[model samples]
Target: MDTDTPAVSAADSRVRRPPTADERTTLVAFLGWHRETLRVKCAGLTAAQLADRVLSPSGLSLLGLVRHAAETERFWFRTVMAGEPFEGLYAGDGAFDVARADERTVDEAWAAWRREVEFGERFVDEARDLDVAGDEPGEGPVSLRWVLMHLLEEYARHNGHADLLRERLDGVVGL
Candidate 1:
């Protein structure tokens, strides 16, 4: 291993190492960092604060964004990456409220978000060698390159919403 490799605890064996390619690694780093940024935005807020509808007329909130992102990660990683069924959580036919507040909603959403991030990390880990062919069977395939670029875009876009909502929530700004 490189001497510069960051030391990790045995308990955190699943933690992935960053790619070595300066540019490519930079892109991936931004997405991964921003994902956590979104998580930070939702931190320490109450359920009511998380479910605040004033953030958007359509009822978008930090909690809802978490749910949406978790589902989005599942859609792309599980459904598209692993070719698994797309019938996982939050399959509510574009209904934003489907991810609305509930007792276990936030917990479930965070679990899923973490799971999807790990899933993404695994994909990228093995992605250095393999070429992911087109999108899906009935859906016209896209290249793995496209998927990577798109995921970065997805997190970046949502992080923008997260930025604004977090600002309104506690006035925290500029990560």
Candidate 2:
């Protein structure tokens, strides 16, 4: 653990869960909430803490989740929806590999995540409608609507993992 590691706090950073809204608004808000959920799980932790894989048999940490989330956002939105030519931020199986992660790596991971999130948000906002489809390599055409729902599912699952990892790391637990 580095003595200079700064504290992180994200308890109040999450967006309120959408109580009622249209399909797109509801989906976007829920996804945004899940995005913030990941941040909350990582709050008040140093890079060492963020990279701590306390759960054995699972090479998962808060920072790893952050990196993975960035990859996920870029893949589904930027690559699939926006049809950008691509190489991933941490291409292939590298996103979850946190063995050598330090403060710099942690910062880079978060920056990538924020960039991808912004891209995804804008992509969703500017689409003609959720019915717009993108040519997904293996799956053929996939709709923005489907992508939004799938992203919601993906974040829900990973955020659950983050919830467990965060508790194991520090015993700090909340929404």
Candidate 3:
């Protein structure tokens, strides 16, 4: 069994952002940082370790976070921005359900996350500008800037949770 099928290297070797850049560049850089942070946190773990409820009573495994992030990516990019049909990868909170998680499940979650992330990048790149609008829940015509900020916050918040989860899993902390 692949005990550590890491998707990224240590946080120290992160993707460096330009010292100064435009709003879009900054937003994308920050989002990329947070995404890499998650990958760093989840590194060096077996399938069982990735799926372990180290915090028990809460099924927020590293694998689960990847799954949910994929879901979020699809929601914001495909459903809201492109008016594409939307469906959750897992039923209800099944994204957080890792009781049956194994190597295959871990691979699937990672692949889905990577796909959504790539699609989101492509969508953003093709947009006319940050001012490009989309229909947000209960809000009419929210701009791409708003979506970027929302996703930034979402990933930041989840990354914090990931910090805790990783620490509990093996006392590995800081990122």
Sort every candidate by lDDT, greatest first: 2, 3, 1
**Which lDDT tens digits does candidate 3 get at residues 66-118?**
88988899889998888788777888877777765778888888888878888
lDDT of 2 by residue, 1-175 (tens): 2322223545567677768888989999999988877877776787888888889988888888888899989999988998998778885778898875677887788888988999999999999999999878989999999999998998999989988887887787775
Candidate 3 residue-wise lDDT at 15: 93
| TM accuracy, model 2 | 0.92
List runs of model 3 lying over 4 Å from the truth.
Answer: 1-13
Which residue runs does candidate 1 get wrong by more than 4 Å? 1-20, 93-95, 98-103, 137-139
Model 1 TM-score is: 0.76
| Top-TM-score candidate index | 2
How much is the lDDT of residue 25 in candidate 2? Answer: 90
Best by lDDT: 2
The sequence of per-residue lDDT tens digits that candidate 1 reaches over residues 56-152 is 5556777777777877777777788777877757657442464346546666667767888789778867775335754565667866666667777
Distance from true location, Cα of 100 in model 3, Å: 3.5
Using alpha carbons, what is the TM-score of model 3?
0.91
TM-score sort, best first: 2, 3, 1
**How accurate locally is residue 126 in candidate 1, as Cα lDDT from 0 to 100?**
74
Which 10-residue span in candidate 3 carries the lowest summed lDDT? 1-10
